[model samples]
Target: MLEDDPFHAELVGSWLRAAGHTCTVTESGEAFIRQLGRESFDLLILDWVIPDIAGDEVLARVRTMLSDMPPVMFVTSRDSEVEIAMILRAGGDDYMVKPARKLELLARVEALGRRRSAGENDIIEAEPYRIDTAARTLFMHGEPVVLTNTEFELARYLFRNVGRMLSRGHLLESIWGRSANVNTRTVDTYLSRLRKKLSLGPETGWRLSAIYQHGYRLEHMGIRSREGAAAAE
Candidate 1:
């Protein structure tokens, strides 16, 4: 948690610890960034204003450096609609006004943790592609494929809803959190990255299709039959 106010930081940190989460509190954005470099966190609770670097700028730097972005919640006194929108657009997953209620804060944090944990507990299989949710790992044809955290989550989500058309808004909310106000173009950019990284195409026995006036879908190319026949020999 990156917070300048000692009272709020202690309060939030205590609450998180009571709820069985390991909590780290940083009073400055610079310290937060340094800690982030050495540790991987599931969630980031940030204050809009900090002693050094502002929260939004810190978030931007983090997004630039990390491929598997952690869920970020801004806890700040800046409650203006414009400020909130700007923070969300910059990739903050959630926002809370200052003097936040303990219960609500705990609830949001738990929800983010649960969502991330859920993604890690199940395996999604699409023939050659094997995704281990718990391990956050992917394999293609028994060979491991390295995916950044966000990429792994996106690929798993697509595989989970295979053949289903998911709207851009739905994906943004689902993956980035309901509070995220990111543009649809962000989804397009990530989809392109996923496609190239995973080699999603006709020859790969999988197709990630874009629907006109709709969204996207990952379709299996029914190559299992060929594999089955070849195995029979």
Candidate 2:
């Protein structure tokens, strides 16, 4: 966590530690960038205004330097629409207004942590599909499936959370690294591409179901009941 205010830093750090996460709090953006260079982190909680440099500038630098950039959340008093848009455009995964509630903060942190954990394994297998994380490749039925970098990441995330309803916001945050100021239509477009490319349907025993007013779930076709089928239809 990069926070200039000592009190806020300690408060946030304690909250994270209580949730069983190890956290390092930095008082300046310069120190935060230095720590990032020395160590890798799963998530970053940043304050927009810092002593040495602004958080957005630090985020830009991090993006340029790191290939696998960690999830970043901005927690700051600056809650204007313009500021929020700018921060998200600059690569923040999530944005929170200052004096964050403990429960919401913990929830967001846990969500980001889950995304990181899901991505750590080098190889992932879901029956006919095999994913090679190191090479960023996907294979199905012993045959290779060509996927762009974004498409591969999206497929991996979906496979990792199979059977769970994943909100478009969650997918956007986990894959694109920005939760706010993004068009959910982008997710719809990708899902369409994935469904076509991977042959996801009843024939394959896998179905990506879009829940009305909710989100999407990747699940086995057999598990969906007749009523569920009717509703989906």
TM-score of each: 0.55, 0.53
* Poorest stretch of ten by lDDT in candidate 2: 222-231
Between which residue pairs do clashes occur in model 1? 120-133, 120-134
lDDT of 1 by residue, 112-147 (tens): 878766665487778778899878899988888878
Instruction: Give candidate 2's TM-score.
Output: 0.53
Which candidate has the top score in lDDT?
2
- lDDT of each residue in 1-233, candidate 2, tens digit only: 99989999999899988876668898988888877655446689999888789888989888886666779999999989999999988889899998989999999988877887776788888867899988888998889998888899899988876766677766876788643566779998999999989988754668898877556888867645534665676
Error of 1 at 158 (Å): 20
**What is each predicted model's overall lDDT from 0 to 1?**
0.82, 0.83
- Candidate 1 error regions (>4 Å): 118-233
